[model samples]
Target: MVTNEQRESAFLWTLDLLNEGVVALPLVSQDFSPEDWAFVFEGLPQDLRFSLWKALTEDKKSSILAAMRDDSREQLISLLSNQNLEDVALASSTEQLVEILDVLPKRVVNGLIKKLSPADTEELEDALNYSEEQLGRYVNHDVYSVNKSASVGEALAELKLEDLPVYTDSILVVDDSDHYLGQIDIKLLINSPKDTNVLQLAEFSDHVLAADMTLFDASESVKNCGRSMLPVLDKSGRLLGRFTIKDAIDVYQEYYEEQLSHMGRVSDEDLFAPVFTSARRRASWLGINLITAFAASFVIGIFEEVVVQVVALAVLMPIVASMGGITGSQTLTLTIRGLATGQLASSNLKALGNKEVRVAFLNGILWALVVSAITSVWFDNPWLSVIIAIALIVNMLIAALSGIFIPVLLDRMGIDPALAGSVILTTITDVVGFFVFLGSASLLLI
Candidate 1:
């Protein structure tokens, strides 16, 4: 068995070679796991990593890339040589190719497109024509579609001679004009008599994905269909390509990472991007937050007299705002998730809002009692306890309403809900929480 010492020694040796400008291709391919390779690549200087990456064969590079996560692959692509980039684009599936293209500059993309074969160029052009978030951008243009009149034997003969596309599970059935008719499962074709026509066994009435469908909607189609591949058709019912399960998964992962970055108020910057660049990207959101914070401070300033009169009010007011912020955040997260997954739509908004209000009402009653009891015992002031309890209930109700509406409004305004929703939600919760508590105290306690 390999000991920790042995692993460390090997890793260090690899690091030395990488630092010294040695490619170490054999050692990398034979000795290192994909994880090990990624770790080593991450440690090397950017220039040196590019040099080492250039030294590897195309197949080796593809294997390493396949092993890495999307973010890691993106970083590597950013630093790759033009020739290396061409190789990857040529070899990658349409989905992977689109991902690489998405991060590249227009000039570089145009340059790379010139290097590809006519067939690849056509496929890439089709993908490029669609919006970045559309399923058309990720469709596998290399799909095989047989005419409905073709026999199983003819289909088998075609598969034997043609270069099969990746993720091939079913042969798409099309009409004489190449319009999509249905699909024939490979297994069914293989088991059927050679003389049997494809139309006899075709699943003619099945779910077909529209090429113009958004990636989010396409993913939902993929989930509901539960098939290995779904035929993608254009507006005219022509079979353009296929959207494989693997492509659907890649779309899901890309959207997931994008949403996570949006939620964090970052633009999915490369992990090794310059410190200044990363800082600049975050500064905008931080600036917005600062303004919101000032707004909250201004509300507190309005009740300065009450705070001074009852020093305990200052100490306890933060608890009310903090609870509201946390409660609103929970609702915001759920609403954003529902929207992202296509589960929540405008039609369902009324029902969802009512459900959240009911939930908030129940939680408000229970938690208000708990806080009121604690405050009464701590300060030995029943009136102060009652005021805080009322404030808590009001804030909780407002928090729930704000959480649901903020994202919906942002989405309607064409702003990214995930990115802007939390900031607005926090502002609403803090301002309202402070206003209700301090305003109540000012009138009642004073």
Candidate 2:
């Protein structure tokens, strides 16, 4: 068995190979995890990284490209020469090519498109015409679709004339005008008699996607249908292309990454990006957070007179605010997740609000009793305990309501709920918690 020291030595040697611009594919294939590959790629110098990438097989290249974050992919693409860029673009699938093009400058993208064949150029131009969030931008244009009136024999003959599209499990059926009809599973087609009409064996589905549909909506359709591929249609019902399960997964991953970046208040940046580039990307949100923090502090400034009158109010004020902030954060996270996953809708808003309020009331009563007992025993003051307990219950209930509404309202305003929701929720909780606790103390205790 290899000792720990020996294992460390082997890992270091592998990393050294990557640094020296050596082809380590055989070793990487046998020993490295996907994460290990990512680590090595990240550690390599720019020139060496490009060399190693160029040496990878098409499948390995695709895997690595998919595994990389947007920033890393963009950095690598920027480092390539025009010829190298053209070669890489030509070698990739329609989906992969779109991803590569997304990071490049518009001029570079146009130049690369010019290098493509006439058919590929047209398809790429079509994809470029759609907005980034639209399904048309990512659909695979290189798909196999036969006329619906064709016989199974004719379909088989067509398949022999050209290679099948990648990741295709079924042949799409279309009309003379290129309107989508349905799909025929290749296995079923193979089993049926050759003279049979293709339409007779076609599996009609109502789950066709529209080219202008948002990626999120298209992914939902793909998931609900559970098909290997879903055909895309234009506004006039003409066939545009097809979206595969792989494409749907890519969309989901992109959406998830965007949400994560938004929550951190940072755009996705390369791990090894230039220091200033990374800082600039983060500075905007940090500035916004600073402003919101001041807003919370201003609310606390208003309660100074009450705090001076009763020292206990100052000591216990944070407890009320902290608890409210935590409770609101829980609700905020859940609501944002529900929105992202399409699990929550406007139709359920009233019902969801009522449910959350009920939960908050129950939890507030239980926790408030515990805190009140502790405060009474410590301070020898029942009235103070009762006041704090009431404050807790009130703040918690408001926190729950604010948490549910803030994200939904922001979403309707075309703002990202995950990015702004936490900040807004914190401000509300702090202001309300401080005002309720201090206002009550000024009236009763002070």
Candidate 3:
């Protein structure tokens, strides 16, 4: 088997061939997987990518396209003929086909829709009816099964006539109505009495994903249930398809990518996209940050006289605000992670919030004392030292509570917590920390 590092090297080697104006297709049989080809395809500059793509056979194209990211695949997809597009759709999962169709021209979609068999059309339409996050959208239709009442020898004979499905740990056993009942392992089927019923030899399992279950839930279930794949069923328990380990892995990668994008308040865009396009996508977030910065500056302006009376306040204020910002970010990260994993439920939410506040309060008291000792020795003003200590404790308490509440409130209002939570937390901590420290000095020293 090719290791990931070797697979990565394959793309570099193939790109070397391309730069020399050499044909790239001959490299397909050189132990590099379609995934490696996908990397090479995506790595190529857009102008040169399509020329190499046209050289590949449809089978090669289909496999490589399956492994490529959506943006890169769509670039080549637009150049494919109707027959090639049809073949791609047939090879894709329900959700993938729906997304592919979304990008096609209206005329092309109409033509493509007609070419699909009635069953294929229904499945595609059915998949589209669910939310993108739901399992119904991502179901793999390439499933193999056997009737539960069939004899073991007959079932074994049927397996010999056809190829096994993807992630075929066992032959799923179903009834005449296509209601999933159990599974018979290939080992058991071969070793069982020839005349024994498949149902008698089947391993019963309730592990399944409902069509409406979110992909994240399905991923967690797949891990916890100790199964690499599970039967996907409708509300009526009729087997719709299979949710395999590959699907679970896709869900994980997608969630990680989404969170990374949301953290920067930026679109999940291609790296080699136009400079203007990437700039336009990022500029809006920068503008929002500027607005918040002005708000923070406005707070400092309110304490203009407080700072002039004691220039040390200017030097020490940042120390207070920086501490609060770091502390709040730590809490916010935890809250967002919990929400993503479905771990922050009603029963545990209040406890988590309280525990965070207690942790913050204790750390505040401990660190404030340490800062006060330093301030007393450096400035030789006990009053300034006391004021800074009080300010630290107050700001930290506020930071902790804001960290917990901000994410919960944003989620309730249908906004992504990871996207805006850090921005909002930073603004609050800066403004509040500055206000508390300077306000105490004005009241006590002025």
User: For each candidate, what is the lDDT?
Assistant: 0.69, 0.70, 0.71
Residue pairs of candidate 1 with colliding backbone atoms: none
- Maximum-TM-score candidate: 3
lDDT of 2 at 339: 68
Candidate 2 C-alpha lDDT tens digits along 349-385 = 5555765576567667766787788768756778878
TM-score of each: 0.57, 0.58, 0.63
338-411, model 1: which lDDT tens digit per residue?
Answer: 46544355544665576566656666676678778877776688887888888878887898788889988888
Give candidate 1 regions above 4 Å deviation. 1-48, 60-78, 81-94, 161-167, 301-446
Lowest-sum lDDT 10-residue window in model 3: 266-275
- Model 3's alpha-carbon lDDT is 0.71
Q: Between candidates 1 and 3, name the one with more favorable TM-score.
A: 3
In candidate 3, residue 399 scores what lDDT? 86
